[model samples]
Target: MKASVKKGLGTTIWLLSMIIILGGALAFALNPSPAKSIFGYRMYEVLSGSMTPALRTGELALVQITPPQDIAVGDIVTYAVSPDGTTVVTHRVVDKTTDSEGQTVFSTKGDAADTVDTNVPAAAVIGVVRGHIPIIGYIIGFVRANFIASLMLIIAAILVVLAVKNLSAGKKKKPANPS
Candidate 1:
């Protein structure tokens, strides 16, 4: 490839990668609580095999904020297990009905379990599981635990890319002809 073309391609790839990484980092940083969301979506790290076959442990679950009234049976939902919203659980809604107060209540169960769990009130429901990325939760956990090291690695990667681009550009240059 021509040197100019190579340079352009490299720059484009670098910029795209940086944008994705930085955007993810920013989203992760802004939402310190799993119950909180960024762009209407909350990210939670699956800690158990409760929803196995659909969602596995070590995966990152992407839950989108959905109205409790819109939630239907068979939908996977993440709900706050504690009043403070610090503890959360993801399970499949096996039943849905209106309580005496006219509020929606959901009965959830783990796919691998034989028994249904206690009914969860609408107020405790965080959102519905939209999607998940396998094994990304582990990587995110590591990055969070070693944030400084991860940042340094990202900076080093950028420097290496720049150095390689410069070296390639230099090799593409030709010496001036003898006078």
Candidate 2:
């Protein structure tokens, strides 16, 4: 096979894999509805805007699911908006509140917002925001609002490209015609 064709195929495969993983992760992160979580998605909503100049309104955040003890006062955490509801809220920990039972609660806020949020019970937290990629959160939010179809498309594309590459590779190794 020509080196140029090999290079093109290699690049396409690499790109397809990256997009599938990254897009899937982003989609999963920003869309944490009760339905999604049961399916293994961990989602959080934007509040306060305190993290701004960073995170902003409507800019949902994604986090790796974890326990509350893993949270720190300075870390960003995502938790339920109401004790009775699954509506998730995301904010930065600015203070810690503990109950008489020795359970710890966390207080959080957004950098662009004006006030502190209600106390978040330890059990209320879903996970911490280890990092973010800015406005990209909104893109994930858009995909979520739209549905899971786009994500499935990207995943399908990745699989198809990978399969095609393998077949092409097999064909490239055949010997020239020998009469």
The candidate maximizing lDDT is 1
Q: What TM-score does structure 1 among the candidates reach?
A: 0.79
Candidate 1, residues 1-179, lDDT tens digits: the string is 99789778978897788969886775674456755667999888888898888999889999999999889999999999987897899999999998899988999999988999999999999999999999988777777778888778877887897888788878778687899
Clashes of 1: 0
lDDT tens digits by residue: candidate 2, 53-81: 65665555667777777778888777777
After superposition, the stretches of candidate 1 with alpha carbons farther than 4 Å from their true spots are 1-30, 174-179
Which regions of candidate 2 fall more than 4 Å away from where they truly are? Answer: 1-50, 57-60, 83-85, 147-179
Question: Which pairs clash in the backbone of model 1?
Answer: none
Residue 127 deviation, candidate 2, in Å? 1.3
